[model samples]
Target: MIPPKGKPLSDFPSLPPGFRFGTSTAAYQIEGAATEDGRGPSIWDEFCARPGTIADGSSGAVAADHYHRYAEDVALLKGLGAHGYRLSVAWPRVQPAGEGTPNPKGLDFYDRLLDALVEAGIEPMVTLYHWDLPQALEERGGWLDRATAERFAEYAGHVAARLGDRVAHWVPVNEPNVTALLGYALTAMAPARGLSFDALPAVHHQLLGHGLTVQSLRASGAASIGTATNHTPVWPASDDPADHEAAAFYDLLWNRLVADPILLGAYPDGFAELMPGPVADDLKIIASPLDFYGANYYNPTAIQAPGKPSAPATATAAGHVEVPSDLPFQFAPMTGHPRTDFGWPVVPEGLYELIMQLRERYPSMPPLYITEQGCAYNTPPDADGVVDDSARVAYYDAHLREVARAIADGADVRAYYAWSLLDNFEWAEGLTQRFGLVWTDYETLRRTPKRSYHWFAELIAAQRA
Candidate 1:
């Protein structure tokens, strides 16, 4: 049964047996030992240091301080009744220079974190790279250079050989599409290059890196390995042919460009011709088989032709910037939808459309898992140190219902990991956006469970009941 909005989760349908529930976090966002334990600077470190780069003029220097207080953080996950935790290993921490000898101290920190998670009965799924490229590598052209891919393979071999015994599930990279577009093309994120389509090389190299990492992980006997790619359904602003044409192109660029190479072993239609270095040979590497496919979904995008005027709308609750006018397509706000605190439209049903489309499009599609899904609500704790975020709770309920509906429709989805477990430093946005079940006090680094946390815990327990 579908649980009505604002009601208890008791009426919600249970996920299938062995369906995993978890929370995800990136290292640079939470682990704030930025300079400790021989950890080198990342591109993020350099990006955050620049004036006027981050929205709040802040950096993740301290973040949630998870590096020193990971045990406390794990307790939060344990209390939430989560079966898994998807976390990223900072590349700069693992290989301070992005090459050469490994950092013993860096590896030791994760060793302790994994031990703690295992003790708490939480499965750890590790993501090798999550946009925090070592600054040393950026100085040598970063992802733009093909050598970075080779270096990434070497680093992956080292990490897999050491942690593969404990970590069965591996994610080679997280959202390379975001890294390429936001960071390189738009300069909206770290390693702010703003090179536009000139950054296409980054896309090819990152995927090559992912493929190489997968091969390295397999060599180390890793069980399940996949990469997380962010996706959103594209909608025309109206039924006009111009809007339709724009949406089609945007869809190819945003969704198909990333998924096609991974799932179908070729670029969308003609995009491969545009990519540099290799047009065919690398496609073989990029199309390596996966145990499961990971997707990060937020909402559908409404696109209009470049010359068409965008619809007048209030700012999004999710704080996504107004779509740039210089783009080939314009973005219009989704009408008649609830908005998250960051001004993002709440469209739980979009998740259903996205996954069903994937099942329809790819014959070789593997079991699906949501690597990241969450809404940012900057709600503060009350005087009693409690955050009552009923909206976030309702958001999860509505979205999970869509997930269940998709599964019933034969999507083969096996797991769902919330975007984050705690409020940490959101890249570029600094710490302003809080997309966490647990409210984190930036000053004290104290974690207080929000109402959503209790709701999710009860839902997880019910799934097992």
Candidate 2:
């Protein structure tokens, strides 16, 4: 059963003055019209076309119809009293072939969206790449090749030159670790390459792309620049030395590999030596200063050395995918904790621990932002026509409390953007997962606010007050 909403603003944790509260959406996840406005096909488009790729046998071809109803979505944001709106400018939308000419029609759509956001008093934060690599670039070696990094810089420059004036916050890339590890190394995500540990080059190239694009965004006179990295705490399954060592290695691979280069201008110990190309030279580019650091936290993961404790992972309300046991470290399920619809344990303290770790690990860590944090739950409308997602409200409240605790402990977190504004097309899981605060009737494409939406709106109003 879903938990009930807690209390009013006075009873909840207080955030600092001018701290941003917003919602996020990715291009391939929310923006439909995949083939319209001369938009070139993306890797996601290709992946979805293949049978058995998306669980629901559905694609983002129509999505929530946000491409045609962005105004309505903007209105939703304004009504929620959002201080910011984090969105991605589809690379293929701007440069259909990933290089060469810019698509005027594609740029026009974002121009209108930005103008509307500004009119609604919402700060627009633009993310350059969000897992939707144009198929043209993928065909030519994708992130594995150095040329893709150069082409990415060119593409960033194109969008920044046009929208840089209005958009203050610029994210060059989002969750490169997820893209390289899942999409390239593992078979879970798009462009399902499944190269396993051999996909190290993709990681380096993505970071290189980020660094190059940071320079491009700067040249375009963008004010605030950052990249969203997916982060989570790694816990050992037991006190055994092998378990601890395996957990440490997994941490180095999952967290430190990409983060160290960006925040500290170096990779985790020997990992850098393994990355392809002139890594020493690339580190200088990868370590470019960021105005802020964006972290997307889900939950902490427990690990054990391979071939130890083969307990079956209990499926949650929505089930979960099993981790490959052949890896150096095996994932052990968190035994006792509330879970979301995605079978992820609801460990809000992990967010606090992650922020504190960043503070302690990197002395030069930029101001932090909870760029993406939210859960997926099947809390559709009830018989009274109300989507009373008290579970989501509790989830937000608990996480915000943790954020407030971190702030009190002197962590410089400045923003929190929920993972999504509306429930549209969830990648891989397809329509099975609903992470939005607003419910969408996919058939009629009608938008309906859930109970969590109102709860969040009230909190935003109280913050301003």
**How close to the true structure is residue 215 of candidate 2, measured as C-alpha lDDT?**
86
What does candidate 1's lDDT look like per residue over 1-465, in tens digits? 223345667778767889999999999999998999999999999999999888898787899999999999999999999999999999999999999999999999999999999999999999999989999999999999999999999999988777777785899989988888778776778798888788889999999999988888887888899878889988998899988999998888778888999999999877888888766989899888899999999888898887766755423212344456677787765788877767778889899999999899886798999999998988798888789887888899999999999998887999999978999898878898999999989988888999899989989999988
Residue by residue across 1-465, what tens digits does model 2's lDDT show? 224675555887778998989999999888899999999999999999999988889988889988999999999999999999999999999999999989999999999999999999999999999989999999999998899999999999889878887897989899988888778887677788988888899999999999999988888787799878998899998999999999998899889999999988888877877888899999999998999999998888888888877446533211244557667887776878888877788888999999999899987899999999999988888897899988899899888889999999999999999978999788888888999999988999999999999999999999888
Name the TM-score of candidate 2. 0.97
Which residues of candidate 2, in runs, are more than 4 Å off? 1-3, 310-322
What would the TM-scores of all predictions be?
0.96, 0.97
Worst 10 residues of 1 by lDDT: 313-322
